[model samples]
Structures are given as C-alpha cells and as structure tokens.
Target chain A: MSVDKTTVAKIARLARINVPDERLEPLAAELNGILNWIAELDEVNTDNVEPLASVTGHALPMRDDVVTDGNRLDDVLSNVPEGASGFFVVPKVVE
Target chain B: MSDLLGLNAVAARDALDKKAISAVELATAYLGAAEATAGLNNYVALTADHALAMAAESDKRIASGEAGLLEGLPIGVKDLFCTKGVSSTACSNILKGFVPPYESTVTANLWAAGGVMLGKLNCDEFAMGSGNETSAYGPAINPWQGKDKVDLVPGGSSGGSASAVAARSALLATGTDTGGSIRQPAAFCGVVGLKPTYGRCSRWGIVAFASSLDQAGPFTRTVADNALMMTAMASHDAKDSTSTQTPLQDLIGAVGDGVKGMKIGVPKEYVMDGMDNEVVTLWEQGQAWLRDAGAELIDVSLPHTKYALPAYYIIAPAEASSNLARYDGVRYGMRVDAETLDGMYEATRAAGFGDEVQRRIMIGTYVLSAGYYDAYYLKAQKVRRLIKADFDAAFQTVDALLTPATPSAAFPVGRKIDDPVTNFLNDVFTVPANLAGLPGISVPGGVTSDGLPLGLQVLGRPFDEASLYRVAGVLEQAAGFTMTPARMAGGAA
Candidate 1:
C-alpha cells in the first residue's frame, strides 16, 4: 500500500499544502516509509473491536445549555491576518 | 543569597516562607540567569517585567501571609501554550508573529498558583518533531555537550522546557507531551518529566498537537518538584470538555510514599536488539534500585507493545491534520495572500508549515481520505485499543510498569536520521504511555559513555500519577544523578 507521486500530490492538495512537482517523488518515498511502517497494524485482529477515539476514562460531562461566555468581539478578531469593521477579511468567495 | 539560584522550587518556596529570600530577589536571580543562558536557545521570550511584576504581587501576598503553593517560583512556559498578550508560536513560521489574546488554562493555573513566568520557551513546531531541529527558530541546543563538546539536541518538542529546567534557567518548566515530547526531552536533558493521565490536566489554552494524546506536565530537577508543579497544573475546566472532573490527587504529598510493598512490572518486550547498551543497563539498574527500595519486581508483557509506535503515527497525524486546518490564512499567522480562498489556504499553509508538518498533514489527509479511512484511521484506533488493553492487563498484576524512557541518549543536532520513520523510532518506549492515557514519568538514571544522560520510565494506571512518581522517587534516589550539563544557567549545581 505504498503511496506514489500522484497519491502524494492529491493528498497534498486535499491537505491544502502546496507541494511542487519535483518534491512529490521524494515525498512519496518518505510517505511510503511511514505508511509501510503503519501498515503493520494489519497484523492485529481488530475484528468486532470498538475504536477508541479518546482515552478519557469518564463520560463527557453535560452542561446546561447557556451562553456562559461572549461579547469579546475584539478578542476573536485579534489574530486575524487582516480585518476591519469587526469582521474577518478574506479573499472573496461568492461570485 | 546568591544560592537562591541553587534551590529547587520546593526549597525556594521554603526559603521564601522563611523570609531568607524575597520573591523579588528570586525572580531577579532567575531573570539574570535566563539572560546568561540565552545561547542555549531555550527561551523564545524572557518576560522580565512580567516576572518582576508577578514577583512584586507575590511579595505582597507573602506580606499578607496568603502565599500560594508555587508562590514566587519561576517557571518557563513552552511556546505552544497561549500566554495572553505574549506570542505563542509553537516554534512554527505559520504563527511567527501571532500573539494569543487569551491565556491557556494550564499557564493560567500556574500563574494563579503564584508561579512567576520566566518566559515562553522553544518547542518543536506544533509539537511535531522528535528533536528540536524542526523548530523554525532553530533547535534549542542541549545544555550538556558530549566529550567532544559538540552541541547536542535537547529532545523535543519540549526540548526547550527540558533544557531550561536542566540548565537551572527555571526551577520548573511546563511541557506538553503529545507523544514523548516531555519525557524524551527530560531523559535527554537529565531532568524529571512527567506526562499525567489524559484528562488529568486542562488543555484549554495549550496549542493543540494530537488532541487525544496531548497531556500537559512538568519538567523539573527533582521528582518532588515535578509533583509540586503537576499539582498546580491539573484541574477541571469548562473550557476543555476533556478536562477531568475527577478530584486531583495529593501529588506532592505522594512523592515520598516510597515503593515499599509495591509491585513494579518489568516488561520484557521493551528489550530490543538495536537498543543502546547503556539504555538497557539503566533499565536493569532501575529495576535493581526499585527492588532495593522494597519494591517487588514482577515480569510482565503488553504483547501489543511493539505495535504502539506505528499506531501512534496514524492517530497523531490524522488528528494533527484536522487540528491544523484552523491555521488557514484568514484567521491568524503568516499569511500568503492568494487569488482565491482555497488558493490562499494552500499558499499560506505551504509557506507557513515546515517540511515535517506538511508531510504529516499530507499523510493524515491520505489515511483519513474517503477510501483509506477504515484501512488506516479506524484500524489504527483499534490497535490503540489493543495497546491500552495490554497496559490494562499488565496493570491488573503490577502497580506500575517500568521501562527505558528513550531508546538512546541525546544525539548531536542533525546526527539523528532525518527521514520521518527512523526519527519516530526515538520514541519507541515513551509513546505507549500516551496511547494508554496513563501517567508516565522519566527519571534521569545514568549517563552514557559519551556522558549524556539516559532515563528510566515508570508508567502507571490512569489517574494514578501518585504511584508513578513514587517509583520515580526511588529511581532518582538510587541513580543520584548529580552530574550537571557542561553549560548551565544561574551557575547552579
């Protein structure tokens, strides 16, 4: 199940990371090494076993539905790359 | 008074209580020492004014006799933690100029406990790399040089934290362990590093690495200091749903309980052919030490032990890729404006993330992609369950499991193989604890022939950090690891 240049490139795009054409070959090889190692998980029989998404030993604590926090308009926008008028500025998406 | 630098957090706290050293004096000494050790590249920011002001407040609290547990104790904050108004980059170019507006729950807790901020320390970008090399600011050089005097790597991504604590730049340093980030660096730097149970500490403010595996802990010069710092760090918070409502244990109080009549397991699976000879020796020495401390050593096996690392790779990256999606150019960090929204995300992320981070993101995208989801992501999670089951079976018979912290000691910066899989092998022994959601600690046990420190690890049942620290105390005592790095801050012993 080794990934090739095409697979690497596709995933790179899907991952939103820009990888150049020449770099794709080397990345495929490196990714292959990691994937090949991870393929070892196939040796274990996980049949009928539930996937453990988290290791938290207890149930998620339920809380009453309430807006316990808010109103810090500036704080949310504090780290925006570019912002004005209390809104995040981004490249236009809607045609 | 100059010996204020020599005191560990516990002793320093005692001195402050006795009025032998004022909080201001201690902060001043640590701040000066932090400046002196700038060459180690441990600190990304030195909050001297913050420290002094906090120390001044601590002095007033002392005057009122309302001192907190870590009152006046200086600590180094990992750059991964969001310190309000201070930049928390996680040592990545993507977040190069980003200053978080809110304080992380862990750092906020430390400050609330009267722990003074020394500064934000360096770390692997988003806590991804095994060594500090992946950091954009450059690796934090290990304070300990080999016989040849070549600068070594303080293990990552908590390398800066380990280096600072070992160098005495800070009495204690906060480190987040997603995998072996905390323990590996602690082992390499000859200090105590502990990764508490998964939900033991709040993750509200620390930068997310692998959400499931990430646990906040401490790096300190002594086991007791680790206990003191851990007590201050863990808490239940509404901000982090994963934060535990389980009551916090008396960690510092449990440090000296000793391992008498305790059952410590020695897992044979940890022994491997390619492992360093000195690391093997140290594990054996640790077993002998625990036995000498009245512990009954029993042989145990977590049959799934060998598969832990491979499983970790899938799960960690899968989660990382998802978590890092938040770094799109629009919100924060280094932005490379592109013609379109998707184009902007691609360009900014590509330019912002390092080679290692990009690779992980790519792999994660591959594994979790539509068709490969079950074959990779789900399979890995099942394997994780088996790994936890193995630990459960072992813990049923033994109170805690002991193993080597890292496969080897610190290597010269760049001496380790750069390829991803080979480098991931460095964490062979430490990652299982993270996977199991259990408590694990690294105690500096011995030095390699090259004079680099190696550590022995103790993994305990979930929420049972007390047992883990108890065995660490025994190993720490038996090892008597007093050898200081060639270069240390504060001229500390």
Candidate 2:
C-alpha cells in the first residue's frame, strides 16, 4: 500500500534506473499514488473471473515454422551497437 | 488547395480522383508547409523522396485505372509505426538509430492501399507520457497558441501527428493508442481521432508497449476523414497474431447512417469526483445534441470504472517492463561501449532513456518483479477482465457508450509531470475501451472554459467500428467546431 525508501531503492536497482537519495521521497510518493489508484481494484469481486491477457479469446496464432526473415541481415545489423564479422561483439564474458 | 488541411480524407481523396490535385502536389504542399515550420518538432523524419516516389506511382496507377479509394492520398505515419528504411524511434533516444528491416503491417497496409507516406511523426518516448514533453526528440509545440503566447502542448503520445494535422503539415496522420494517446491529443489539438478495436489493426513491427491493449488508428481534421483513414488502415494481418479475421466495414457508408434510434449510453461512473466543470458541461451538451437528433440517451453502468485506471497502471507497466527489456545495449540503439556486459546494459539504458521512460520502466519492473507478480500484474489482469465484462454487460442495454475523453483540457506541460499518478489518471476514461478491445473515437465537443478544446469519446462493441463512426459523425455535425492551427500565426501558447 505504501512504498518506502528501501523498496524504492530495490525497485530502482531491478529497473536499472538511478534515483538519488533526495529524489526517493518524491518517487515514493509517486509510487504510492499509483498503488493507491491500483488499490481501488480491490473493491470489485473477481471471485470467479478468468484473467484476460488478450480481449480476443483466441490463442496466440502460430506462423509457419519456416524461417522467412533471413535476407535482411545487413539492414538489421545496420544499427547494431557493436559487431564484427556478422556477429554482435560484446564484452568477453568467458575470458 | 492550401485550405485542404481542413478537408477530411474522403474529400481529399475525392479531390485527387477528380484530378483537382495530384497526390504529389498535395503531398508537396504539406511537405513544404511542414518544412517551413520545422521548429515544432512534430516530425522525427520526413520521407520527402519516398513520399514523392509513392505519389508518382499512385498517379501512374490512377492513370492505369488501378487506383484504390486511398490512391494518391498523403498520410503522416506515426513514428511508432515501423517504416521500412526510415527511422522509427517512438521519439526515444533508446531507439535512436533503430529502423525496422520490414514495415509494420499497418504501414504496409496503408501503402498497399496507395496511401503516400509523408514521414514518421514524433511521439512520447515509447509512447509513455500524456503530454508530448516526454519525447527525447523534444516536445512538439501545439500549433495553436493562447493570447498570452504560452507554448501549448499537443497531447501525447500522438502529439506530433495531432500538431502536424492542426498545422496543415499532413492531410491525415496515424496514431497508436495503448491508453488515450490518439484521442486525447486529438482533443487537445482539436482534431478527430479514432482508436479502433484492439485487434482492428495489426501490431507486427510496431515497437511494443502493452501488447494486449495497444492499437494503431488515425488522426485527422474531420470525422469523415478519420473514417476514410480507418478503413484504409484496418485489416487482418496474418503476421500480427492478434489481428482480427473479421471483415473490415465500409466506414464511409456508416457515416450518413447518423445516430437516429441508437441507444447512447452515458455511464454515471465516469462522472468522477472533482472533474473539470467545462468537460462536464460539454459532455452534457454533446448528449443533448445527440438526444435532439433522435438518439435515446440512457444511463449505462460500467460499475468497474473505478478499477480501470488502477488496473491499467498495473497491466501497462508490467507489460512495458518486459517489452522494453529487449532494448539492452546488445541490440540496436544508443549504446555505451562499455568494458563489460553488465556495464554496457546499465550505461546504455541509463544514457538512452528519458526520465519519464525510466520511471515507467522502474514501476513496470517492480510490479512484475518475482515477489510482487501476483499482487500487482496478475491481479491487474483479473481486474482487466472484469472491466471488459462490465462493458460487455453494458452493451447489452445500450448501442454504444459515451464519456469525457479526459477529465479536463490539456494542462500546461509541467502541470502534472512530477505527479506520475495524476498523469496516469489522465487515461482513466479512455483506458476501459482498450481493456475491453472496443472501438472508440474522440470527437471535438466544444472548448473548455479556458478556451482549450473539449473531447468526448464514443465507445462501441468489439469490431463495431460502423456504429462508432455513425455516432461520431452525429456529434461532429452538431458540435460544428472546426479547428485549424494556421489561424495561430506563430505556434504560440
């Protein structure tokens, strides 16, 4: 129901966002307002209701198993942050 | 010809068909005007060469008698919609250099129908904010200004499209609504916007937000224009799994059908405590006009209305947190060439994302976190179903529902920015339709007491866009308020 400084710090870490100590108070209040708004949902009796992910009752339709999107490799990698020899270059984790 | 910005898509299409103006000429005029007022930040990228080429092809097709209804028409594609070979950022730095290898189904469909693309319009970063100020590209200026010269914000995340249409920069524009992005901005800028049924348009290649609720629709100057653009944009796409297989309706045919004998439902619950007086007054006036024109105004109940805003906050952010996780430095976009993987992701995301975007991502991550999933995300989904059920039950009694799009007119840019909850609450009235996957539209009702535009939404059953357009057409005619931004010389306010 309420977001404390500790929870704020925890959430910030999980979300990979930086919130200075001074900003935590305001952030906590903001998070509380959202939580308070969300709390209103408790008033309803959803006792037997099914949770909905998609409003349309249909299942996620599957496409052909074949890979059709292979030719645009150059365009796809055009904006890649870092790459060498057609593979994305990242920090050597194993090394 | 210069006044063509006021023309709806149908009228513009008609003008093009009669050879009154070529598509290239029409697009050129808007392109010229948009470039002339480049300071508004309405465009992230303008495909002048692409648009001209497409226009020429449209002319050739028309000459060959192969023209479709939208042939040779110019449209502003929202930056959120993936444009092949064009920059699509959703106005966020995180996606700074990202361009989709393929076009989004919606964009492709528009092109297939012979619609010319003017370019990608600006939007809130990842469509995160109610005001356009959250865009990393810079906030789009509301082309219309108040007398004191305050810079008015064209509402977000479709702010650029709304502002561009208002400024006569494009004949028509596309907008996405996860919440009220399209309609709210349309209202603030005094344009017409329609968010069709959630599955009405395909989402393939659209940068994801809340996949369940997000939908792409149109922003235009008139109700009929919206109808035309909607028809052109709406279709079943095999690539987008959620796209409806249901047949698309003839929106233009539904226009003249009017609101006669229709049961217009006004839910009492949407009249929330502490609503702005102008919105309340205008909503009543809009109802009266409908009743006078033969619509039977009836009280309908969406008893779960109070739950909607909260439910939306939980669901949207929970989904957003997961969807945005793909934006790590490993993929395309602004990346910090860090010494390590952990360092890379942290530095990339921290530097790339804007404040509001980061805040949302944080909230989203927290809600969907391991210990809190059931209490937040899953519980919200259950409430989401209940909200949909409320609309389903209400529709059994009323033909369509009407409500204020927002509790008030557009506030000053920073008015609610610091207050995230208040900002999220702005989507309260509009979120139910998204939750329910219903077709909804925001029509210009009247101006607020402060002279800002007023918007009221008409909501229809799933895949029932025809019914939505008829009611919108009725209200649009009765309101008789046509807004244009060229009237405001310097884009002040």
Candidate 3:
C-alpha cells in the first residue's frame, strides 16, 4: 500500500492540492495510515448490506426545470481574481 | 444586571421583552467582549457595523411589536456559511476574497428569524479538523486557562463558535456538524451544541464537506438557548433538495416536559477502548441521575459501531474531494498567479488550504480514485448501511440513544496533533449519528475531578428532535451546567 511519488503527484493533481516534493514522503505515510485504517472495513461481512447513499432514505426531490438563478453576475464576478467582461478569465485551452 | 453573559435564552428573551435591555445594547456589549478577545483568534472576521445595524433594526421591530423568538439576539455565524456580500472563507485560503453573492439558506433563515449576526467565526479549513488548530486563521484559545497552563485548544471546526459562546462573546452561535465538529467542541468548551437530523437545516450555500453527513446546528451556553437557536435555524428550505419538511416545533417547551418514562438507550458498542475513566464515571453518574429521574435506562447494542469511524473516514473524504473539486482557480476563490491553468489550480490550492484540510482532500481523492472506488468508497458505503441498520435496530426498542460526546475532557493544545489517527478517533462515539443522519445533542454532563468539562450526547431518530430534546433537557437539568468558560476564565475582570 505504498504511494509512490508519481501516484502521489497524480492524486494531488486530481484533488487540486499542491504537495511539495519534500513533503511527499510524510504525506504518503499519513495517507497509508488512513488507507490501512479503512482496510478494516473490508473484514466486515457486508455481503447483504445495501449502499447507504444518504442517512434519510428519501430520494432527493428535485424541482421542475426552470431558468432562474442569482441575478448578481457582476456582484459574483467582483470577487474573481481574474475576470474579463462578465466571464471568469483563465488560461487559454483550445488556443 | 442578571449577568447577561451567562443568562440562558429564556432570560435574554425576557430581558428584551421587558425592555430592560435593548438589542442594540446587548449587541454592543457582546461586540466589545468579542473585540477584547480578538487575540484568541476565535473569529476570522467580525461585522460589528452590520451587527449594530441589525440590532438597531431589531430594536425598531421590538418597538413595533414584531419580535420573534430569536429577535434582538446577536449570534456568531460560522465562517463556513456563505454570508451574502461578506467574507465566507471557511477559514481557508482557497476561498480568500471570495464573497458569495447569495447568502446560505440557513443564514438567510437566521436573518429572517430576526437574529442579528455578530460576525463570521473561525473554523477548520472547510470544516475538516477535530481541533481548531487546523483552521488557517489559527487555533482558538479555550479561554478557560488556570494559573498552571496556557490557554487550551477549543475543539474543532465549530471551535470558534464554542470559544465565542464560552467567552460570552456572543449570545448564541451556529455550528455545522459532519462528524463531531459541533458536539465535541461544545464538550471541550463547556457549551451546548445540537446537530439536528441531517436535513433538519438547509445545507445550500454552506461550503460542503460530506453532503450526506453535513448539518448546521447551534452552540450556546444553555440547553434552552441551544433550543432557541436550533429552532430558528431548522426549517424546510425548498432550495436544499434534502431539507426535511418536518414542522419545526417549539423545542423550548418540550425541554420543560422532562424525561420521565422515556426509554433512554445506552448503546454497549459505543463504550470504546481508550476512553478516559472520568468520562466513564460522569456517564455512569449521568445515567444514574436519569434512572433516578424516572426514566428507564436500557442497554442497546449497535453492533456496527466500530465500522462507523472507518466508514466515515472513507465516505467523508470521498465526498469532500468531490465537493472541493469545484474550487479551481477559474472561480472567484483565490487563484495563484501561474503560467498555466493546471499550475494555477495547484498553486492556489497548495497556498490556500491548511495542512489537515489538504490531508483530508488527498485521502478523499485516493479513496474515490478509479481502481480503489470499489475496494474503498463503495465498500465503505455498504458498511455505512450496516452502521445505520445498527442504530435503526437499537431505536426500535429505545426512544433515544445516549453516549459520551468525546472519550475524554478537553485536552491541552497539541495533545493529539502528531497522531492523526488518535485525533480522528476522538469522533468515534459521535460520528455514528452523522453517518446515520440522526439528530444528536450534546449537553454538559459534569466536570472532571480535574475541572475540565464532560459532555453526554443524545441521538434521536430522524426528524425526531422532540425526543432528543426531552432526553437532553432531562440530563441538562440533572447536570446543572452553570459553569461557563468565562466563569473559569474569570468574569469581565
């Protein structure tokens, strides 16, 4: 159950977390401990158990589709670190 | 002046009704106290101007005979809840400078209930830690220091609210409980905290951790005060798809009903190893008192209790990793200046979140990763169902379940910092309720012989807060929880 540097980097990227190369070993160890802890759940005889997605058994009752949302686009964009016009500015992708 | 700092909600409400003190006056007094304790780092941000303005409006409403139960009371809103046009950072750098244009439904509900917001309190980065130490702002001091010690660590994610209430900085405060964030800290800080049924309050606009387990409740110095805040906070919000449609009842009156003839279930499985002796003793004493008070104590078995902690570790992080994925640099949240978008995301998240938050996120990502999902996340979900079945079976015979909030009283700062497993285990007894989405309340049990506070938690069936209140109120009355951290910290000096 060892998390190598490559795997650690990939997981970090997927999680959007930045892990310094120096801290990777310690981070991996901590993650290993957690994974080991989680491995205990495997010993349980859960063959008959159903997956509990939510505490309440009720399904999420969604509303009818509607075109409504917060009308404060300018207000929202005001907090953006980088913005142009009314859209969030980001690095060019296709270009 | 009746020591308004320690007065319960009933007394505070009566004071406002009698015009003995105006909402503005109470808000000012609390604001002053909070400002004085700013060194403790209990609050990430304070809106003194907004508080005073709201208080003034509340006073006007009182003058016009339009007061509600929470009217004129100043409360601390946990920083995790998005405050419209205000900083709702969740005590993390990732969301720095991000002001949500819309208020969290719960926040809007509080304001609608006429409660005045004093400020946003500090919390663990995205509500991820057991001790407030994980907060990016810095850990909040317990404010209960004696001659021999430095200030203590207020327990986590809700630590700021607990510290603020304990320090008398606010009359009441809101807290979100995913695991034991509210109850564990309330016990450590000697305050009352309630984590109502999972969907009891709307999670809309709240910075999500584990959506299935996350719930917003209240923290206050008294059980009645906790009820006041909880009632105001719990509502059927159509916006939150999972919000319960259960009619909010007057839990204050239910508390007066007492626990006579109630079947109080003490589950055998929750008596975990490594629990402190004093907590065990206090739990026994609490049970004895409940039994003497005409309540029947039943020994129930929740066989899958051991699986809860591990299941939660898998499930909470799994959900957290997903919920937090939305906080990429392209959004309004903090973004690091980098050469590329991927680099920007990495830099921003690395610079933004605290260590513990990062650990959880990484763990969450790993568990939910492609190959491991079946072995970890999916299996944990199945175990989660078993854990719920354990409670469901226990509740069939008993009206409510009771357990100690934490294994021990408030530990010194840095006690469990190095050992993340021990810190995670601190929520062993409390996490089951969250996993099962059951409502739970933590009341002051008794102080240890060493003088630290002890807490007992009562878990109830879904949407059955009335039973939880009845049982908790009985224990609260028997416990006679009069010692606030301020009393220990020395009053107003």
> In order, what lDDT does every prediction score?
0.91, 0.84, 0.85
List, residue by residue over B1-493, the lDDT tens digit for candidate 1: 7687789888999999998999999999988888999999999999999999999999999889999989999999999999999988999999998988899999999999999998999999999987888899998989998889999999999999999998888889999998899999999999999999998999998889899999999999999999999999989898899988888888888888899999999999997667999888888989999999999999998899889999999999999999999999887888998899899999999999998899888888888999999999999999999999999998899999999999988988878474678789888998888898998999999999998999999999889999998888888888888999988975533
Candidate 3's displacement at residue B222, Å, is 1.2
Error of 3 at B41 (Å): 1.6
**Counting only residues 3 or more apart in sequence or on different chains, how many pairs clash (N, Cα, C under 3 Å) in candidate 3?**
0
**What is candidate 3's CA lDDT for residue B452?**
75
A best-first ranking of the candidates according to their TM-score comes to: 1, 3, 2
lDDT of 3 by residue, B104-202 (tens): 988888898889999999888899988888787888888665445666778887999998988888788999999999999999888889999988899
Query: Comparing 2 and 3 by DockQ, which wins?
Result: 3
Q: State the DockQ, from 0 to 1, for candidate 1.
A: 0.86
Best by lDDT: 1
Off by over 4 Å in 2: A17-26, B1-6, B486-493
Looking at model 1, give its docking quality level: high
Q: Which segments of candidate 1 are over 4 A away from where they belong?
A: B416-418
**What is the TM-score, restricted to chain A, for candidate 2?**
0.80
Candidate 1 TM-score, C-alpha based:
0.98
- In the predicted model 2, the residue pairs found to clash are B145-B492, B150-B493, B151-B493, B152-B493
